[model samples]
Target: MPTLLTVDIGGTNCRFARFSIEKGALTLAGTARRQTADIPDTQALMDACAEALIAPGEADALVIGMAGPIAGQRRARLTNAPLELDLSDAETRYGVGACLLVNDFLAEACACLTPIGAGAFPVLGPRDAATGDGTIGIIGAGTGLGTASLVRDSRGAWLPLPAEGGHAAFPFTGKEEADFQAFAASALGLSYLRGDDVLTGRGLCLLHAFLTGERREAAEVAAQGLSRETETLRWYARFYGRACRDWALSTLCTGGLFITGGIARRNPLVMRCASFRESFYDSPQRSLLERLPVRRYADEASGLWGSAWLAARLIGALPA
Candidate 1:
């Protein structure tokens, strides 16, 4: 059996796990989690992970799914968090045989390719039998908005395609939407607003202030269940649905659209609301959207599993 160390580094928390691979299957061996704020930088984060999860030389490989853009095969810079990682340095500092870094959503997308277990629930449309030849799309809101795709290659292996589509210009459907865009642009001192400006955890607070001239943390607003807060969540869900619909149409994702992130998982009512499905199916491609299966992934440890899967593949322990 081969052992692989996997880490999911996010803005709020960092999760680490060790997996044992045998006969192309991965079994969770040990796991630990810590607040990213407590560990200021990547070096410290990796050191803490190794201390909590495994001995320095026990793992064969290290795979990290980080909440940021991967500049090259060896380096990644997290977006919301103050951390930059060089996988090359990790190999020396952690005593791992190999290290791989990828965008966090790419790991989430990889998880969609495998059996997701029971951490997923339907949100819109009926579950359709995937033809196994089309694309699978994923969109979620956490510390930031994330997007990715899974497509089959010529060899029939599913390939993870990571994207920073979250920073794309947010779509505006009406004057109210346009007003929000202008407000966000002026507030952020940008010419235009990106999706993350209005769809993330911080974005929720911003939206609340825009709507009611009030400032509250995302969690506080969510807990209050006030009319204004409810309105904010509905707006968030609607935009999220639109984002998902756009990705689905662009990728022709006949497989399914899987929603995973801290926000959606924590607020099941908002996901199940009619506002979400209404906006998702409001497109001109109504027939296509209706046939698409949409689900909210409930598991927080999904990225860890995904990183392990990639590690197993990289080590040739799993078939492509």
Candidate 2:
């Protein structure tokens, strides 16, 4: 089986996997990942991936799931990477004929079309949820925030819609704007709203810093089992809940709201907190919001599956 090299890159880490199409299904072979800060440039990263696979010329195509925006058909660059990645260059470097760029979260959502492991049940809201036409929403809080939608078309196929929802202004709900504004003014040096500033891992840290008066990574706060009685931790939980609620309202994810990413899934306290549900249903349309089912993307390989699926489609190896 010819290999397909897949890379899932985020602000913090880079995950690489090798997949081969087998009898109409994607089978994983070898996988490796590295931290972004450790790598110096794009070439080095790609080289590391090639080395991990141990077969430089075996892959038929390369699929990159990047944290940045992808545009046009032939070339793309990373929004956060200091260096630019030209996909067409691969024709010479790897002798590969094709390259594909896709949003990392979109890949994860597409992977959800397949069966995954258990999920963290979420509190979903109702709006236009009906048979055959309702939309599915994915809100992931990881190194950063990621939002995507799966809309069921008339033909009944789940179509993926990718967008920069994380960059959207963080809509303040009641005192949320006030609290967020204060945090931003004091830390970020700007009071304007940013969805990532509140919905991401760093956002959680920012909230912790404001309430706890200590600067630390959000993942650390949740991992260390910090004193829940501390006002800072309490405030962080409240804000986290509020952020999830806000996305739920915007999407009206009656089909269901999926919360994924490292920060969200690792923090069981955040999910179990009563405030999380309360804030989720705190909207004026609580009755409508109460009916939506919510869950977390439990499968870590979900993103890898997405990349492989897209690769199969682009190569015309699978029916659309």
Name the top TM-score candidate: 1
Per-residue lDDT tens digits for candidate 1, residues 223-297, read 653233377767877887788888888878888888888888877776776677888888889999888778878
Regions more than 4 Å wrong, model 1: 128-131, 225-229
Could you tell me how far off, in angstroms, the CA of residue 223 lies in candidate 2 after the best superposition? 2.1
User: In model 2, what lDDT does residue 196 have?
Assistant: 77
* Candidate 1: residue 45 Cα off by (Å): 2.6
The TM-score, computed over Cα atoms with residue i paired to residue i, of candidate 2 is: 0.84
Cα lDDT of model 2 by residue, 1-320, tens digit:
65688888787778888888888777888788788766666577668887777443567777777776777533555555554456656677767656777887777767655444133344344334332346667777677778777777777766777867887776565676587677675777765757677756667677666665778876676665333545555555566667667776776666776777776666656666666777777779777667776676666666776787777777876665
Q: Candidate 2, 161: how far from true, in Å?
A: 1.5
Local distance difference test, per candidate? 0.80, 0.68
Q: How does each model score on TM-score?
A: 0.93, 0.84
User: How much is the lDDT of residue 5 in candidate 1?
Assistant: 89
Candidate 2 off by > 4 Å: 54-57, 73-83, 117-133, 153-155, 174-180, 225-234
